[model samples]
Target chain A: MTNANPHRLFRGGAAPAALPARGGIGLKPEHYQYILDTRPAIGFFEVHAENYMVAGGPFHHYLERIRADTPLSIHGVGLSIGGDGPLDEAHLDRLAVLLARYRPESFSEHLAWSSHGGAFFNDLLPAPYNAGTLARVCAHIDRVQERLGRSMLLENPATYVEFEASTMAETDFISEVVGRTGCGLLLDVNNLYVSCINHHRDARAYLRALPLAAVGEIHLAGHAREVDAAGAPMLIDSHDAPVAREVWDLYAYAISLTGPQPTLIERDNDIPEFPVLAAEARQAEIVMARHAKLEAAA
Target chain B: MSAAFARALLQPDAPCPAGLKTWNGSDPAKRFAVYRNNVVVSLVDALADSFPVVQALVGEEFFRALAAEFARANPPRSPVLAWYGDGFADFVENFPPAAGLPYLADVARLEWLRVEAWHAADAKPLPLAEMAARLADEAALPALRLALHPSLRLLRSAHPVVSLWAAHQAEDVSAALGATDFADAEAALVVRDGLDVDILRIEPGAAEFVESLLRGAALGEAAQTAAPFDLPATLGLLLRSGTIIEATPSGRIS
Candidate 1:
């Protein structure tokens, strides 16, 4: 009963499930009753699918009693799936009723384009990857993975401005939108340190040409320095303060090139307490237990 | 400028371009006025967090110059900036610099009914002793129908918009504006119940008995249209004022 269609469940190579490579935190409303009374070992909880696209009390009964103690991820910041306008059948029927009620192990959004002729510029903006906006962003990520019958994780956006007809390369338009719609990526390391400091380029060479085996999940937040109408300083990914130390050294070099995955620690605006975001999810679980003791000493 | 003339300078009947010399790389209108001033300061901070009590009754510099002129006459359509100010309390009732606050359009319709009861749509509260033993069984009270609390917000106003929204939550609003009443007349509900956004008020036959059980009537015709207010103290002030968080008798309607 779990086949949600990506051309018949991603034609049998499947993937997704993985996550719990430790470190998680971004469940706010000032930490829902201190994460249901301190059950914080910190390794799973994500929320922001438009802040529980609500329809009841106590925000989905305290997110279904913290989705019966952890392993949830629904991150979507509005599915304007790179809008030029078209894909919004009531925001994909309310994201297929929140992926048929939080069967969320993963689900994400943003490749930038906060709507146009149908209006919505609530920020994120930047899109022009060209071959006619990469076949209109792979026909809007294959009609949003054929109407949320699953497959999502898009992410990669933190641009300030770039488009003189950009001929593909934000890791080849996210490796051709995961080679035409298998869809999965979420990356975000403080949006690769605010798009490599607002486009001078090289957040470790865009984390060495990204596509880390189509990632699946990773985001570490906080940015803001502003200046740009030519006063210089630039930056801005603004998930509002705390997460910096060089974006925690580009999230411990993107968890040592995307190995131990499910990391979060985002702070949507000066929100502190839930033990200061579980001490920034215990500094991303001591950098994923020092990248699992350097991959168990090689 | 061409990336279709800087995305046709964010359209409104596009055209402008006799301007930039270098921009980021300098002049190209200094890199399109820094992505058009961070797209009008992140959509005027998402219509000032979708009207914080109309930016606390128009103050944050007159609601950031009326959210930068109602975001150039209504900009957002729905990249879900929390359902982008559902037509900003009818664009501040035809904003001519907020026509000297006619209770700023019922306090932007009680901040769009607390952003539609903070994005409503979850219910399952039936147990008030199983809705009072199915209202003492008149065959389970005409197969009951009640399911309120998708952040339940009802609101009604003629002016003292909940004491001008509790004198914009007084942490010292010029000493709670010299003892209130600039024009008292109100009705409200605004739910959420367990993460604060409460509100309550009601009473005028308890807003027509919770608008006849939010227009689907029957709790015996919403306690006979809340019999001139006091149907068991408006159903015990809507179940102790969390405006009835859950009630479903007719084979539990979803």
Candidate 2:
């Protein structure tokens, strides 16, 4: 991994404020005009960095205006940080250019891989969690953070299957990667619940194993339920429907551990009217608020 | 594992990658199918976004099947799905099922250009006042050169690509309208007027003259080469559409 151009990506101006400790929502093209026309009071707006990787368009046209007032989270879905091969330097360069243009407050990528053998899978694919793989993942994160000249939050992946070659637990692997690379954790409560249910592990135990102190941001999204072969329960991290009840409970529990962190409600598919999603974001704020009251009383 | 996993993702028939595990000891194939579906469905969705007219022309199911085949064979080399389906027009032209609609390939080409135009670099267009003032000197018209908007793109097709695309934008596209004789050879200009992308049909001769000007030809040389062409009409169209970024006179571009 090489830091081809080790420089700050900011274009100049006062730095944007950090993601506020409140509720935000994923920015979608369908809601761009509506978001601008009726300015919604949300904490921050997160976008898949790949979607804005292009030179220019309405995505930039609206985002430039929206970002002027709102905090932004540039989540990279295509960086393939957990890739077997080296990070895509060209892709990284594009990410750099985009960040330079927007100067987003918070940047993040997944703990999973998406591209391999020069072909981008577009979905974050899983990998075996082992010492050998750990080193590679850490190296990739080091390059990403160093190349961008900023710390990034690495989100936990929502995987359907585990690998036989994995020598360490997922939590241990993630803990080591964060310990080694100095990157922050973006704990996706929905993913935590989905993976735990799929693998028959306790979600609470899994959450407790994580290094909660380094969590910079949290994600809460919807998941679809389906049984795999042999009628075993399986969950797909589909961001279509609203957040499930159990995940919200887990989110409340998560905030109890990490206190009030910036949480984003991601509705990638079947995206509804901005108000519908905004209501969900407000739901997250309620949960955070509930937990905050309990902590303040304590 | 990634190498084999990626290969299996596109080739659905292939066996699941070695060493994949699900906690319950059930077949990992079903679990693996999740990843396969994500990769294939998401890529197809991206193409559907980039080439909506192509999808609308062929109907939803057929388009998804066609786009799925195209996706597997031509999965995006780049992660930016905005630029996916680069070779789709070529692929559709050769596809056996699409042999019934020869114009589709051209329509897809036009649609691909629209995708490019939608995302092309932003540039300020020459104001109508500025363009008029530059062309004020009728004597300097021939030596005048035009710089087009960054998002300006031209597509020429034997089929009426513009009509096919415009018909789809309508709320209700009648079958008669769909089968109408819009087979006349056509050329199109896709440009962004203030943030909205506008697609205008143009005559082939005008298209050629603009194409020549795009190559840095002076107005006189370009118009002369595109003989029997309407120079004033084409220039008016370009100016009215806000396509001209700058109008430089002879030796001024240097």
The lDDT per prediction is 0.71, 0.87
DockQ of each: 0.16, 0.81
lDDT computed for candidate 1: 0.71
Candidate 2 local distance difference test against the native: 0.87
lDDT of 2 by residue, B95-209 (tens): 9999999999999999888888889888887888888898999999999988888888999888888888888887777753566576588789999877788999988888889
CAPRI quality band, candidate 2:
high
**Which sections of candidate 2 miss by over 4 Å?**
A1-17, B175-179, B252-254
TM-score of chain A of 1: 0.32
Q: Give lDDT tens digits, candidate 2, residues A121-227.
A: 88999999998888888788878877898888889888899888999999988877776676778999999999999999999999999978778899999999999
**Please, what are the lDDT tens digits per residue for candidate 1 over residues B16-62?**
35433322564345444555666667777777876776786667898
* Each model's backbone clash number: 14, 0
Error of 1 at A117 (Å): 32
Which structure among the candidates has the greatest lDDT?
Answer: 2
